[model samples]
Target: MTDKVTINIPVQYEAIAFKTKALGFDMPSDLQTGSLLKTLVASKPGGRILELGTGTGLATSWILSGMDNHASLVSVDNNELLINVAKEQLKDNRIEFICGDGYEWIAAYKGASFDLIFADAMPGKYDLFEETFALLKTGGIYFIDDMLPQPNWPEGHAQRVEAFITMLEKRTDLVLTPLNWSTGIIIVTKTSNKI
Candidate 1:
């Protein structure tokens, strides 16, 4: 009963998966997932949000579009190339960009939980559940993308992903939902009223 996620894509699979799907070529995250994120922020107006693995600032833009004026976002990424793209794509003061492994920074952050969290940096064997739950406030939202057919993922990772899901379901104060779209994102809601 372990969870697992795959991150590898075969050429034949890529053909159908990325063919004519998003602004030409292929978008890592689909519009449906992006729009869902935006909607989450809009509904949770004024919420503090965190974007993990901000690739090229695409998701960052969507989060901004979904959030209200009072809300802010902190985006993290280890890729300098993507960070540069994010810098050019975003001009808002509310959005702060950080370049590094999310797990390292998260280890030092324990002040308060964020309202919304988007996890996109699924480095091999870097399941950030500990850091994610630690920073998530009660009633906050946590979204983890890329849980299916992990493009180039190591073997048995998909099983690990599933195990996490099973474990998530066992938590009493959290709600979990596995989306059936683009890579099967996991949505979790913390409701313990805790710090």
Candidate 2:
């Protein structure tokens, strides 16, 4: 008899997994979540990607594996300890690891819109949905993860997902699909700039 489970992970991502575990940072994206990010990134060749709350860069590695050579990624995290681990692990020219308040950085950014944005931080912490939406090019994908109830989540955390859903539903500029996979993900695409 054999008990087996198989999943293919890129070498960079594998390294991030080990490093994150060694650092006791359990917030790294699971394999399924990472794979999903890779798939999405692959869809947009030369995409400009933004990742908030870069926890150990497991997902960043996956995204880089799929992104085109011309694509660029900016991953931000407030924790110096965690971001430094990611920066050292992923020493690629295509990626810029920013150690600072993600919200503040995004708020001050006055550059071209992104092709993809992955919001890995807790959903409710982001109060700049309009700004984020504006920063995403029309038809660009915005991913928000960890929306489902988790074993470690405090009581009432699920309500945050609900409120987020409600907010998305009210917005006419974006289309939303709430998927019940890998901690639940809300996939939002900017369909228009209009309110």
Best by lDDT: 2
- Candidate 1 off by > 4 Å: 1-27, 123-126, 193-195
Candidate 1 lDDT by residue in tens digits, 1-195: 422323222112233333324334233555556667877888778888988887666667678878899998988888776666667657788898988887787776665568998887763114757667767788888887777776666789778777867777788878888887766888888888442
Model 2, range 30-92, lDDT digits (tens) per residue?
Answer: 777788888899999988999888888888888888899999998888999888878888889
Model 2 misplacement above 4 A: 1-8, 123-125
Cα displacement (angstroms), candidate 2, residue 121, comes to: 1.2
Q: Where does candidate 2 clash, by residue pair?
A: none
For candidate 2, give the lDDT of residue 158. 77
lDDT of 1 at 127: 71
Q: Which candidate is the best by TM-score?
A: 2
